[model samples]
Target: MPRETLFTKIVAREIPADIVYEDDLCLAFRDIAPQAPTHVLVVPKEPVESIDSLTADHQELAGHMMLVCKKVAAAEGLSAGYRVVINNGKDGGQSVDHLHFHVLGGKSLKWPPG
Candidate 1:
Protein backbone atom coordinates (compact mmCIF):
# COMPACT_ATOMS: atom_id res chain seq x y z
CA MET A 1 0.00 0.00 0.00
CA PRO A 2 1.02 3.65 -0.55
CA ARG A 3 0.49 6.89 1.34
CA GLU A 4 -2.62 9.02 0.87
CA THR A 5 -3.08 10.21 -2.70
CA LEU A 6 -5.97 11.54 -4.78
CA PHE A 7 -6.17 8.17 -6.51
CA THR A 8 -6.58 6.57 -3.13
CA LYS A 9 -9.69 8.66 -2.60
CA ILE A 10 -11.02 7.68 -6.01
CA VAL A 11 -10.23 4.02 -5.39
CA ALA A 12 -11.81 4.13 -1.99
CA ARG A 13 -15.03 5.36 -3.67
CA GLU A 14 -14.62 8.75 -2.01
CA ILE A 15 -14.75 10.39 -5.43
CA PRO A 16 -16.78 9.20 -8.39
CA ALA A 17 -15.13 7.96 -11.56
CA ASP A 18 -16.44 6.37 -14.75
CA ILE A 19 -14.63 3.14 -14.08
CA VAL A 20 -14.21 0.64 -16.93
CA TYR A 21 -11.98 -2.06 -15.47
CA GLU A 22 -10.94 -2.76 -11.90
CA ASP A 23 -9.10 -5.41 -9.93
CA ASP A 24 -7.31 -5.58 -6.60
CA LEU A 25 -4.34 -3.54 -7.82
CA CYS A 26 -5.67 -1.01 -10.33
CA LEU A 27 -8.63 0.76 -11.88
CA ALA A 28 -9.40 1.93 -15.42
CA PHE A 29 -11.84 4.72 -16.01
CA ARG A 30 -13.00 7.10 -18.75
CA ASP A 31 -11.17 10.39 -18.89
CA ILE A 32 -13.24 13.46 -18.11
CA ALA A 33 -11.55 15.12 -21.05
CA PRO A 34 -11.18 12.69 -23.92
CA GLN A 35 -8.19 13.17 -26.20
CA ALA A 36 -9.45 10.49 -28.60
CA PRO A 37 -12.68 8.78 -29.43
CA THR A 38 -11.86 6.34 -26.70
CA HIS A 39 -9.82 7.61 -23.78
CA VAL A 40 -9.38 5.91 -20.46
CA LEU A 41 -7.19 6.53 -17.43
CA VAL A 42 -5.61 3.50 -15.83
CA VAL A 43 -4.33 4.06 -12.31
CA PRO A 44 -2.83 1.85 -9.65
CA LYS A 45 -4.60 1.43 -6.37
CA GLU A 46 -1.31 2.21 -4.68
CA PRO A 47 -0.14 5.83 -4.41
CA VAL A 48 2.66 6.40 -6.84
CA GLU A 49 3.32 10.13 -7.41
CA SER A 50 4.47 9.70 -11.00
CA ILE A 51 6.30 7.39 -13.38
CA ASP A 52 9.56 8.84 -12.08
CA SER A 53 8.74 7.48 -8.66
CA LEU A 54 8.45 3.86 -9.74
CA THR A 55 11.17 1.68 -8.22
CA ALA A 56 12.37 -1.86 -8.89
CA ASP A 57 9.80 -3.08 -6.38
CA HIS A 58 7.11 -1.56 -8.59
CA GLN A 59 8.04 -3.65 -11.64
CA GLU A 60 5.17 -6.07 -11.11
CA LEU A 61 2.71 -3.26 -10.63
CA ALA A 62 4.00 -1.54 -13.75
CA GLY A 63 3.58 -4.73 -15.77
CA HIS A 64 0.12 -5.21 -14.35
CA MET A 65 -0.85 -1.70 -15.43
CA MET A 66 0.21 -2.48 -19.01
CA LEU A 67 -1.66 -5.77 -18.97
CA VAL A 68 -4.79 -4.07 -17.72
CA CYS A 69 -4.47 -1.35 -20.35
CA LYS A 70 -4.36 -4.01 -23.07
CA LYS A 71 -7.30 -5.84 -21.63
CA VAL A 72 -9.34 -2.66 -21.33
CA ALA A 73 -8.43 -1.54 -24.82
CA ALA A 74 -9.40 -4.90 -26.28
CA ALA A 75 -12.66 -4.87 -24.41
CA GLU A 76 -13.33 -1.40 -25.80
CA GLY A 77 -12.80 -2.69 -29.38
CA LEU A 78 -9.43 -1.03 -29.90
CA SER A 79 -7.71 -4.13 -31.33
CA ALA A 80 -6.50 -2.20 -34.38
CA GLY A 81 -4.21 0.06 -32.36
CA TYR A 82 -4.01 2.20 -29.25
CA ARG A 83 -1.70 4.56 -27.41
CA VAL A 84 -0.64 4.17 -23.83
CA VAL A 85 0.81 7.29 -22.19
CA ILE A 86 2.25 8.10 -18.80
CA ASN A 87 2.98 11.74 -18.15
CA ASN A 88 5.94 12.18 -15.82
CA GLY A 89 6.66 15.39 -13.91
CA LYS A 90 5.38 18.91 -14.55
CA ASP A 91 7.47 19.18 -17.69
CA GLY A 92 5.94 15.93 -18.89
CA GLY A 93 2.44 17.44 -18.43
CA GLN A 94 1.47 15.60 -15.32
CA SER A 95 -1.58 17.25 -13.74
CA VAL A 96 -2.58 14.92 -10.95
CA ASP A 97 0.07 13.64 -8.61
CA HIS A 98 -1.17 10.07 -8.82
CA LEU A 99 0.49 7.95 -11.48
CA HIS A 100 -1.77 6.96 -14.38
CA PHE A 101 -1.62 5.54 -17.88
CA HIS A 102 -3.81 7.04 -20.57
CA VAL A 103 -5.17 4.52 -23.07
CA LEU A 104 -6.30 6.26 -26.26
CA GLY A 105 -7.77 4.85 -29.48
CA GLY A 106 -11.01 4.31 -31.46
CA LYS A 107 -9.67 6.68 -34.12
CA SER A 108 -6.52 7.60 -35.95
CA LEU A 109 -4.31 9.72 -33.73
CA LYS A 110 -2.01 12.33 -35.17
CA TRP A 111 1.67 12.82 -34.48
CA PRO A 112 3.19 15.19 -31.87
CA PRO A 113 0.10 14.43 -29.76
CA GLY A 114 -0.13 18.22 -29.12
Candidate 2:
Protein backbone atom coordinates (compact mmCIF):
# COMPACT_ATOMS: atom_id res chain seq x y z
CA MET A 1 0.00 0.00 0.00
CA PRO A 2 1.21 3.51 -0.69
CA ARG A 3 1.89 5.84 2.20
CA GLU A 4 -0.64 8.59 2.66
CA THR A 5 0.90 12.02 2.43
CA LEU A 6 -0.47 15.56 2.71
CA PHE A 7 -1.52 15.32 -0.93
CA THR A 8 -3.60 12.27 -0.11
CA LYS A 9 -5.45 14.28 2.49
CA ILE A 10 -6.20 16.99 -0.02
CA VAL A 11 -7.40 14.40 -2.51
CA ALA A 12 -9.63 12.90 0.16
CA ARG A 13 -11.03 16.30 1.08
CA GLU A 14 -9.66 15.84 4.55
CA ILE A 15 -7.63 18.96 3.95
CA PRO A 16 -8.51 22.13 2.12
CA ALA A 17 -6.67 23.41 -0.94
CA ASP A 18 -7.10 26.02 -3.62
CA ILE A 19 -8.23 23.45 -6.15
CA VAL A 20 -7.88 24.41 -9.78
CA TYR A 21 -8.84 21.20 -11.49
CA GLU A 22 -10.01 17.69 -10.68
CA ASP A 23 -10.93 14.48 -12.48
CA ASP A 24 -11.51 10.83 -11.78
CA LEU A 25 -7.81 10.00 -11.85
CA CYS A 26 -6.18 13.17 -10.52
CA LEU A 27 -6.54 16.53 -8.83
CA ALA A 28 -4.77 19.86 -9.26
CA PHE A 29 -4.51 22.63 -6.67
CA ARG A 30 -2.53 25.78 -6.06
CA ASP A 31 0.68 25.45 -4.12
CA ILE A 32 0.65 27.17 -0.74
CA ALA A 33 4.09 28.56 -1.43
CA PRO A 34 4.00 29.82 -4.94
CA GLN A 35 7.33 29.55 -6.74
CA ALA A 36 6.15 31.65 -9.68
CA PRO A 37 3.14 33.84 -10.32
CA THR A 38 1.29 30.63 -11.12
CA HIS A 39 2.19 27.49 -9.20
CA VAL A 40 0.01 24.41 -9.12
CA LEU A 41 0.51 20.85 -7.96
CA VAL A 42 -1.01 18.04 -10.00
CA VAL A 43 -1.31 14.75 -8.15
CA PRO A 44 -2.94 11.39 -8.66
CA LYS A 45 -5.88 10.56 -6.41
CA GLU A 46 -4.29 7.18 -5.84
CA PRO A 47 -1.28 7.63 -3.60
CA VAL A 48 1.93 6.38 -5.25
CA GLU A 49 4.53 7.35 -2.63
CA SER A 50 6.90 8.98 -5.10
CA ILE A 51 8.37 8.81 -8.57
CA ASP A 52 10.53 5.88 -7.46
CA SER A 53 7.36 3.90 -6.78
CA LEU A 54 6.14 4.15 -10.38
CA THR A 55 5.82 0.89 -12.29
CA ALA A 56 4.97 -0.22 -15.82
CA ASP A 57 1.33 -0.28 -14.84
CA HIS A 58 1.52 3.43 -14.07
CA GLN A 59 2.49 4.29 -17.65
CA GLU A 60 -1.00 5.45 -18.54
CA LEU A 61 -1.37 7.40 -15.28
CA ALA A 62 1.93 9.17 -15.89
CA GLY A 63 0.90 10.26 -19.37
CA HIS A 64 -2.51 11.34 -18.11
CA MET A 65 -0.92 13.49 -15.42
CA MET A 66 1.11 15.33 -18.03
CA LEU A 67 -2.02 16.00 -20.02
CA VAL A 68 -3.66 17.38 -16.89
CA CYS A 69 -0.69 19.66 -16.37
CA LYS A 70 -1.07 20.98 -19.89
CA LYS A 71 -4.76 21.53 -19.39
CA VAL A 72 -4.15 23.41 -16.15
CA ALA A 73 -1.46 25.53 -17.76
CA ALA A 74 -3.80 26.51 -20.55
CA ALA A 75 -6.59 27.32 -18.08
CA GLU A 76 -4.11 29.51 -16.24
CA GLY A 77 -3.42 31.27 -19.55
CA LEU A 78 0.18 30.19 -19.78
CA SER A 79 0.29 30.56 -23.54
CA ALA A 80 3.78 32.04 -23.24
CA GLY A 81 5.16 28.80 -21.73
CA TYR A 82 5.27 26.75 -18.54
CA ARG A 83 7.39 24.25 -16.68
CA VAL A 84 6.40 20.81 -15.50
CA VAL A 85 8.60 19.42 -12.73
CA ILE A 86 8.49 16.26 -10.65
CA ASN A 87 10.86 15.98 -7.74
CA ASN A 88 11.55 12.40 -6.69
CA GLY A 89 13.14 12.42 -3.25
CA LYS A 90 14.71 14.46 -0.49
CA ASP A 91 17.84 15.20 -2.48
CA GLY A 92 15.59 16.04 -5.41
CA GLY A 93 13.73 18.67 -3.27
CA GLN A 94 10.57 16.62 -2.86
CA SER A 95 9.04 17.98 0.33
CA VAL A 96 6.03 15.73 -0.06
CA ASP A 97 6.11 11.96 -0.45
CA HIS A 98 3.17 11.65 -2.83
CA LEU A 99 4.12 11.87 -6.51
CA HIS A 100 3.14 15.22 -8.01
CA PHE A 101 3.85 17.47 -10.96
CA HIS A 102 4.46 21.16 -10.39
CA VAL A 103 3.18 23.49 -13.06
CA LEU A 104 4.95 26.84 -12.84
CA GLY A 105 4.61 29.83 -15.11
CA GLY A 106 3.30 33.44 -15.40
CA LYS A 107 6.83 34.81 -15.23
CA SER A 108 10.30 34.32 -16.60
CA LEU A 109 11.74 31.33 -14.80
CA LYS A 110 15.48 31.02 -14.35
CA TRP A 111 17.24 28.07 -15.90
CA PRO A 112 19.17 25.48 -13.90
CA PRO A 113 16.68 25.82 -11.08
CA GLY A 114 17.73 24.53 -7.70
Candidate 3:
Protein backbone atom coordinates (compact mmCIF):
# COMPACT_ATOMS: atom_id res chain seq x y z
CA MET A 1 0.00 0.00 0.00
CA PRO A 2 1.08 3.58 -0.65
CA ARG A 3 2.31 5.27 2.48
CA GLU A 4 -0.07 8.08 3.43
CA THR A 5 2.40 10.89 4.10
CA LEU A 6 4.76 13.39 2.52
CA PHE A 7 7.68 11.55 4.12
CA THR A 8 6.54 8.36 2.42
CA LYS A 9 6.67 10.14 -0.93
CA ILE A 10 10.16 11.31 -0.13
CA VAL A 11 11.24 7.85 0.95
CA ALA A 12 9.73 6.32 -2.18
CA ARG A 13 11.61 8.80 -4.40
CA GLU A 14 8.31 10.31 -5.49
CA ILE A 15 9.48 13.70 -4.19
CA PRO A 16 12.78 15.50 -4.58
CA ALA A 17 14.86 15.94 -1.42
CA ASP A 18 18.44 16.71 -0.44
CA ILE A 19 19.34 13.46 1.22
CA VAL A 20 22.29 13.47 3.61
CA TYR A 21 22.38 9.83 4.68
CA GLU A 22 20.74 6.54 3.81
CA ASP A 23 20.89 2.91 4.92
CA ASP A 24 18.92 -0.25 4.51
CA LEU A 25 16.44 0.79 7.19
CA CYS A 26 16.27 4.60 7.04
CA LEU A 27 17.15 7.85 5.33
CA ALA A 28 18.30 11.28 6.47
CA PHE A 29 17.53 14.37 4.46
CA ARG A 30 17.72 18.10 4.79
CA ASP A 31 14.56 19.77 5.94
CA ILE A 32 13.08 21.88 3.14
CA ALA A 33 11.86 24.19 5.89
CA PRO A 34 14.91 24.56 8.08
CA GLN A 35 14.71 25.91 11.59
CA ALA A 36 18.45 26.02 12.17
CA PRO A 37 21.75 26.15 10.34
CA THR A 38 21.95 22.36 10.52
CA HIS A 39 18.42 21.09 10.38
CA VAL A 40 17.78 17.61 9.05
CA LEU A 41 15.02 15.04 9.14
CA VAL A 42 15.89 11.43 10.01
CA VAL A 43 13.20 8.95 9.06
CA PRO A 44 12.68 5.23 8.75
CA LYS A 45 11.59 3.61 5.47
CA GLU A 46 8.72 1.91 7.28
CA PRO A 47 5.28 3.49 7.25
CA VAL A 48 5.15 4.49 10.88
CA GLU A 49 2.70 7.33 11.43
CA SER A 50 4.19 8.90 14.53
CA ILE A 51 6.33 8.39 17.64
CA ASP A 52 3.24 7.38 19.54
CA SER A 53 2.83 4.43 17.23
CA LEU A 54 6.33 3.08 17.77
CA THR A 55 6.57 -0.45 19.14
CA ALA A 56 9.15 -2.97 20.30
CA ASP A 57 9.88 -3.84 16.69
CA HIS A 58 10.76 -0.21 16.10
CA GLN A 59 13.26 -0.07 18.97
CA GLU A 60 16.28 -0.75 16.83
CA LEU A 61 15.14 1.63 14.10
CA ALA A 62 14.54 4.32 16.69
CA GLY A 63 18.02 3.82 18.09
CA HIS A 64 19.42 3.86 14.58
CA MET A 65 17.79 7.19 13.91
CA MET A 66 19.33 8.63 17.08
CA LEU A 67 22.75 7.38 16.07
CA VAL A 68 22.26 8.85 12.62
CA CYS A 69 21.25 12.15 14.21
CA LYS A 70 24.46 12.20 16.21
CA LYS A 71 26.52 11.32 13.17
CA VAL A 72 24.88 14.05 11.10
CA ALA A 73 25.31 16.60 13.88
CA ALA A 74 29.02 15.84 14.11
CA ALA A 75 29.35 16.03 10.34
CA GLU A 76 27.62 19.41 10.45
CA GLY A 77 30.15 20.54 13.13
CA LEU A 78 27.54 20.78 15.86
CA SER A 79 29.85 19.50 18.60
CA ALA A 80 28.63 21.90 21.26
CA GLY A 81 25.04 20.67 21.45
CA TYR A 82 21.95 19.75 19.47
CA ARG A 83 18.29 18.95 19.71
CA VAL A 84 16.35 15.94 18.50
CA VAL A 85 12.62 16.43 18.16
CA ILE A 86 9.60 14.42 17.09
CA ASN A 87 6.35 16.29 16.79
CA ASN A 88 3.59 13.90 17.76
CA GLY A 89 0.34 15.39 16.49
CA LYS A 90 -1.32 18.54 15.17
CA ASP A 91 -1.01 20.23 18.53
CA GLY A 92 2.65 19.33 18.56
CA GLY A 93 3.11 21.21 15.25
CA GLN A 94 3.50 18.09 13.16
CA SER A 95 2.45 18.86 9.61
CA VAL A 96 3.78 15.62 8.16
CA ASP A 97 2.02 12.36 8.85
CA HIS A 98 4.99 10.03 8.77
CA LEU A 99 7.34 9.44 11.67
CA HIS A 100 10.46 11.63 11.61
CA PHE A 101 13.15 12.89 13.92
CA HIS A 102 14.30 16.48 13.50
CA VAL A 103 17.96 17.22 14.16
CA LEU A 104 18.50 20.89 14.95
CA GLY A 105 21.84 22.52 15.74
CA GLY A 106 24.81 24.64 14.53
CA LYS A 107 23.80 27.55 16.77
CA SER A 108 22.65 28.37 20.25
CA LEU A 109 19.20 26.82 20.47
CA LYS A 110 16.71 28.67 22.62
CA TRP A 111 14.77 27.11 25.45
CA PRO A 112 11.04 26.27 25.12
CA PRO A 113 11.22 25.82 21.39
CA GLY A 114 7.92 26.79 19.72
Q: Identify the leading candidate in terms of lDDT.
A: 2
lDDT head-to-head 1 vs 3, winner = 1
The true-versus-predicted C-alpha distance at residue 28 of model 3, in Å, is 0.6
CA lDDT of 81 in candidate 2? 98
Off by over 4 Å in 2: none
Query: Across residues 55-77, which tens digit of lDDT does each residue of candidate 3 receive?
Result: 99899999988999998888888
Score every model by TM-score.
0.93, 0.98, 0.93
Please report the TM-score between candidate 2 and the true structure.
0.98
Off by over 4 Å in 3: none
- Candidate 2, residues 1-114, lDDT tens digits: the string is 877789999999999999999999999999999999999999999899888999999999999999999999999999999999999899999999899999999999999998
> Given candidate 2, what's the lDDT at residue 9?
94
What do the candidate models score in CA lDDT, each in turn? 0.92, 0.96, 0.90
Residue pairs of candidate 1 with colliding backbone atoms: none
Query: How many residue pairs in model 1 have overlapping backbones?
Result: 0
After superposition, which runs of candidate 1 have C-alpha atoms over 4 Å from their true positions? 1-5
lDDT of 3: 0.90
